[model samples]
Target: MKMAGIETLSWEPLFVMRLDVAYDRAHPVGGENRRGIFPVVGGTFEGPKMRGRVLDGGADWVSWRGDGTMLIDVRTALETDDGALISMQYTGLSTPTSPEAAARFARREPSPYEDLYLHTTPRFETAHAKYEWLNRVIAVSNGMRTDDGPMYHVFAIT
Candidate 1:
């Protein structure tokens, strides 16, 4: 079963790969935790074929093409299965400045519909964008300002 838009990027008989990939780079970011991990996932979806990639579990980057609409955003986030926090931020398109604005693009429901964005307590010490509650799973699609900009939703899962 798929949770959030983050379905099993790679489905294996007994082990389905979720968006919880980590990198070798690990450090501290301005007194915050730096796990060098990005919880991003990609899969075929309904219309635009949404593809997501995390920058650090905090930012999500997505790309998809529809009838006459092309999407690209890199401002998305996700939590880890082990309760680690990661965040993503884009250098190009201006990301949401406020939590309200950021949330405007945030997923309202889970991916594939029924699956809800799971939440858990972060084990690492880090400062995320704004949202108080982190999501275990997330989906990217068309929306107001969110779906309008380039797919720069960067993500960083555990």
Candidate 2:
């Protein structure tokens, strides 16, 4: 069997979820790993197929790695305006370009998205009959950090 070339793949805009989350705190874990929790307060999402609001109570389970790069792990619940529920999860990395940049990022200070390569691959699940397509496809996400929280634009791989 022959593998398909990369040029055959394409991305379709899934939805943009501007998640509003706040850092709970950070602490040393297992003597070497740094862990933190960021609560998902609230926000909204929109795209060509579905639109919804992100609910609160969901949390981002964060791990600080040795190379000064942050590993993002988040679980989110979305309530579509039409009353459907969608589960969202994403994992990615935020690696700063320099030590100063890393410091600024750690302190929750203003930093550029270009300076810190922040990206995530998002996966989605939903039971709604109309939006069931989400559960079948894979999604790729990319976004930046806002003063309020982290924002993401997810695209489905087609």
Candidate 3:
């Protein structure tokens, strides 16, 4: 029995992996919060649809909100096994359950995703004809913070 005007959404697994990022010490970027840029050193990702390693030089620009939220702008690139370059960016908030959990995250401890809400709508860009589908799809990623960085389970809406 399907409801009228309502369609059930299904998730297609796009990729999953941990992202490695080098945390740059927080600096004063002014105005009411401390700003920091974490250089995305390198990492790996793999799944049924894609498998790739993170390139060097991309970065995550983060702003510390006075609240428990960490506002983030993440820009990174992935080179697939077949040599297609995919550009990805996601902006989201990471909110900790308590000040202690927030401190753990700041200290680069093993703060699990259960201790915070880390969600993002990831947009992809690609030019290869075979992989052009990525540019037309809507995807979201739920991420967990580890000792090294964040791991995301990427899903495409189908």
Model 2 Cα shift for residue 1 (angstroms): 20
Sorted on TM-score, best first, the list reads: 3, 2, 1
Ranking by lDDT: 3, 2, 1
Q: lDDT (CA) for every model shown?
A: 0.28, 0.81, 0.83
In Å, residue 88's CA in model 1 sits off its true spot by: 3.1
Q: Whole-model lDDT, candidate 3?
A: 0.83
Model 2, 18-106: lDDT tens per residue? 87876554333533657877788889999998898999878887887888788889898999999999888889988888888777776
State in Å the error of residue 56, model 2: 0.8
Residues 63-129 of candidate 3 have per-residue lDDT tens digits of 8787758887889999998999999998887888877887887677887778778888889999988
CA displacement after TM-score superposition, residue 34 of candidate 1 (Å)? 36
Query: What does candidate 2 score on TM?
Result: 0.86
Residue 17's C-alpha lDDT in candidate 2? 82
Q: Which stretches of candidate 1 lie over 4 Å from their true place?
A: 1-69, 89-158
The segments of candidate 2 whose C-alpha lies over 4 angstroms from its true place after superposition are 1-7, 24-31
